[model samples]
Target: MKNNDMLKNILVWVVVATILMTVFNHFSTQGQSATSRLDYSDFIDQVHQGQVSQVIIEGQTIRGVYGSGQSFTTYNPGDPGLMGDLLDNRVKITAKPPEQQSVLMQIFISWFPMLLLIGVWIFFMRSMGGGVGGKGGPMSFGKSKARMMTEDQNKVTLDDVAGADEAKQEVGEIVDFLKDPTKYQNLGGSIPRGVLMVGPPGTGKTLLAKAIAGEAKVPFFTISGSDFVEMFVGVGASRVRDMFEQAKAHAPCIIFIDEIDAVGRSRGSGMGGGNDEREQTLNQMLVEMDGFEGNEGIIVIAATNRADVLDPALLRPGRFDRQVTVGLPDIRGREQILKVHMRKVPLAEDVRPSYIARGTPGFSGADLANLVNEAALFAARENDKLVTQKHFEKAKDKILMGVERKSMVMKESERRMTAYHEAGHAIVGYLVPEHDPVYKVSIMPRGRALGVTMYLPEEDSYSYSKRKLESQLSSLYGGRLAEEIIYGEDAVTTGASNDIERATAIARNMVTKWGLSDNLGPLLYEEEDRGGFMGSSRNANVSGEVSKKIDEEIRNLIDRNYERARQILVDNHDKLEIMTECLMKYETIDKYQVDRIMAGEEPGAPKDWIEPDDSIPPAPEVKSSLEEASEKPKEDLIEKDMSNDEVKEPGEPKLH
Candidate 1:
């Protein structure tokens, strides 16, 4: 209580001191004014005392007295107590300088000018810092404004991005001008008004635009396709106007709109209420880009995966002059990309970039980075000093397939069946000339598969042989046959659900698309559209009689392949026994292990396998009467581009 009172007392004294000083300053100023102001009463009193002084009249000096020139007889001085007042009444008038001009009057006028200067100084300082944007003025919004990277700000020359070499050549001419504009102008060669970058996501479209900005050495204004759009009706158009205005001010600038198809899509064609907004925005962009009558130095660079949907106006000649394609790194390109990413990691001594490149067929720059990171993680887990080839192998498999799941439990009986199932696939792939070679085989669960057989075509194959296709079908049936011949047909389940679907589709396509049938008369049964109902949905005529012929041929082919699989399994009963035995023991076997078993060399089988008892009945020849399964001409196997090629680099995988 005492402390609070003492604080209150100190505050009160401070307030009193402030008020007292303010009152003293006001009184002092008043006294100064009063002393300097013209004092008629003082002059009258002086005249009353007979102190002589001549006051100026309209054009002459007057003696201030009752009868002096231009003097008033009755004059009572108004009280100017704090402002030049005197208590005298007499006739006195003055137009000339007073005889008693004081020193206070001169000093007071000199300091009054500084008082006015201080008030103006405070007002201007406050206005400059006045947070008028609800946030702040330009001073406070420094960081909020987007950074403008001129051509000189970046270091990624066109040479940095390796895969899109073709695109670089096209956009380079624009860069030439930004470097030296006079060279092109002298030759009468016009600059590209716009460049549209088209490619799948992560193909480096945006990066290419950055290169353009870097080369031109001009102001680069970058925004998204959706940036122009707003909830309001005219907002998008307004933003387009504003953006172009900014660009014109900074002429010879590059404006990059990433994913331009967002608002520039064929408007009024979409099922929405924003046609007014979209059409307005796109039209405004067109006018701004092409400029009604004047040539513009503002170059537009846009990017989109869906170039097909862009507005026709936006894609017109003057708008987006050239379209650049940034595609995925092909094999040789992938190798180069791998080389770039490889430089960042502490690679193991034996890890060759070429071998890694070969193993990672279709990796993008991002995928290569991930591969390195995965290798690093594998190394760190085992406390290895470097990223070993073994770690890379594991990483590659993990990336293509997924992490191995040894702990995913399966019954011993089920496990034996899965091993045989995968073994059949490995053996068929190895024997078939058209199919890819088996890379690895494992009974370890990954995703939903109880087992997986990994294979990759040795080279990127574009076409398949019919003989190869027939071999693959036989392999596809091997698992079921192995189950049936041993477990008496009841052992088969729905595990080959995926395999059946794929085989059926291929057979149908062979008949309908490939024209691969004898009785079907080499006629395609169906026609699928390539683009927009194959560009036109005109009627394609085919007689009903011809359709029946195709169906009969397809049935005949399926029956023939089924019979072939049964016969092979029967004759190779001994080989089947070796495979199942190995499967029961190890729960897995690679191509080398399967080959060893076929060559009569005992595989390094697991200890826990229950060996087949010697008393089991042998499998008989499938074609006991008819004979000769090998003599028939088989359809070729189709090898797909199934390299880790489709497994894109890790990022927001662009659906485009």
Candidate 2:
């Protein structure tokens, strides 16, 4: 921040210095160019009267030296008679050949210092990260904000990126085409004009694009879709033209636009009325990509998480010729990503990349990178030389659930209630068939929840059966049932609100979208349009009668599952009490401990947990406002939504 302020001050000084110098130069050159200025009539009179010794001609301006050692300057009257009068007066005429000064050159010379000052200011502003956008004032509105890089100049290579090898290979072909276009052109094949990378956020789409640029050995241009649009009319189109012209000047180059959906969203569908400025920009971009003039030797690469929202014109074959799916990294890909990130960290002997990979099933490359960074942070906080598996585990939990709220004060009564609430979830999950095994349960707060009960799947499941869905619903309701059983209906707290919300959403989806209910049959009851990609709903298509039935069906699914949860708790009422007591004692416990207590065995030491070093002070825990509740814990709504393949409820697994 200090450096930025210093640079800003320096830039201000530079601009002021340049302006003063320009003014000083303008005034300083006046006495040297000509001593005095005379009207055109006075200069002609001097020339005709023979008072002028000789004339110096430069374009329309005239400078003359008199016999009195005085010099005068004026504009030519454009009269041929004046030259004849000068000749008749025996005046010496030293007419130099017209200086072939280009108008552009003259203009450049006049404004060169100002332009240089502005350029320097822009350079400093960009360095300070403000950028030369509207923030630079109105004159900079039309400028292209694209960042350019040369293959040899950029440090990011294909090797720097991991977990998306197939995406790398797909984009690598563009590099090959740029390196040797004739290899495929000779075989009557034309290179694709554009490639669109479609993926979820943090899936390394932009990283892959950068790697492609590094490997291509050609000029690369990168800009976000939002950079193209401006409040000024025609600015976006002007920038698009400028960008394409620059790409053409450096042929066989790549132009990458990240988050193209920002500008490339379906035209005329914007909230405002149609014929907006953004629509105009998109139209111009379409024209430039594959218009009447082909964008030959220029490959346009675009990336967007919401490709479903982009204009069809932008996605059509001739423009974005290929669509590459850069999905979340699988186990092997995640392991590779972890290894790549692990290179930067000092890992202990116990730190296993494969084990971490297995634990992080749906992590993207960015997530894995963050995981490695967090683990390193944890190690540093412990004052340890190397990041251990225990640090990695804590990092994963922090990333998933949130950092533990160690400083949060909990009363004895509230803590007990939290214990029973979490124990209910674990007991039902452990007893339910087809449900994922209970991984951990904790009454001590983490994130927004007062307590958490996590489930870890033994293996990744692509498809969920009806039985598994039922079991999930049953497990979701167990916390609420236990609260009612222990505290009675009047005393149940709002802590179960989020869990119920998630469970209800799942049940609703099953009836309205999934057609899981026998009454709904195999037909989707909700409004579904193939046009709305990403499975987004535009509106409900059902009538009042159908909507009523859908509501009833959802309610029935929830009620049945709620009853099943109640019965499971009722059958193991004594075990539930024991688990709650164990939770109150431990504050935090794992699935192994829960199982042991349920099996009537003494709870053992936490499974595979590394004891914290008491000599070293732990890192200060940072709280997330997203999960900090007014009374109870708030949920990480984003993580809950992202982890929809498993339980959607915010609980212990969310912290995993």
Q: State which candidate has the highest lDDT.
A: 2
lDDT of 1 by residue, 212-266 (tens): 7876678888888777666656667877777777777788888889888888988
Q: What is the number of backbone collisions in each predicted candidate, taken in the order shown?
A: 11, 5
Candidate 1 total steric clashes: 11
- What TM-score does prediction 1 earn? 0.63
Q: Give lDDT tens digits, candidate 2, residues 32-128.
A: 7577889988877777767888777776777888989788888886878877877887777777776586899789778877887887777667756
Give the worst 10-residue stretch by lDDT in candidate 1.
Answer: 629-638
lDDT of each: 0.66, 0.82
In terms of TM-score, the best-performing candidate is: 2
Clashes of 2: 5
